[model samples]
Target: MRKPNAARDQLLHDLRNAYEGGASIRTLVASTGRSYGSIHSMLIESGTPLRGRGGPNHRRRVP
Candidate 1:
């Protein structure tokens, strides 16, 4: 699969920074209008230490 776009990565970075700076999930959703699940996944993939089974735990990629 193709890599994620640079703009998207930048947005992800910005969102993470905002989240780290005490912005609530609700506030993030309101400000960016992004779904909670999408934001959560981005945060996880961006390597931000997250709660619960944050990483891809055990599933293997198919060749």
Candidate 2:
């Protein structure tokens, strides 16, 4: 079993690298074995800037 603090540290480290490396939340979920909500929450808790819902001109796209 993983220790709680160690796991949290590792998660933070991975989150920084992955987020800076342009890995999407879905990708982080697949790699970190964490849920989408968990990852999103952690990102917020860590003060990591959240990306917008879509790409640059996504809002301009037709439904």
Candidate 3:
């Protein structure tokens, strides 16, 4: 498999910014046409905090 492109990284950064600015995941996904899993993984890799943290199953703090 080829390495991930800069588009993915840039998309992740844009998604992170949109998310932090109060945009919903659904909105971002719809607008960007990116998968939720990909977005989630990007956030994980980029160390971006989840918009809604502290859910029932989420114990990992966003720090």
How far in Å is the alpha carbon of 38 misplaced in model 3? 1.3
Q: All models: lDDT?
A: 0.78, 0.82, 0.76
How much is 11 displaced in model 2, in angstroms? 1.3
Top model number, lDDT: 2
Task: Mark the regions of model 1 whose C-alpha exceeds 4 Å error after superposition.
Answer: 51-63
lDDT of 1 by residue, 1-63 (tens): 758799988988997898778776667888888898888888887777654433478888899
Instruction: Please list the residue runs of candidate 2 whose C-alpha ends up more than 4 Å from where it truly belongs after superposition.
Output: 1-4, 55-63
Q: Candidate 3: global Cα-lDDT?
A: 0.76
TM-score of 3: 0.61
Model 1: how far residue 61 lies from native, Å:
49
Backbone-clash count (model 1): 0
lDDT of 2: 0.82
lDDT of 3 by residue, 1-63 (tens): 759889977877887888888877777778878887877776777787786643488566988
Whose TM-score is higher: candidate 1's or candidate 3's? Answer: 1
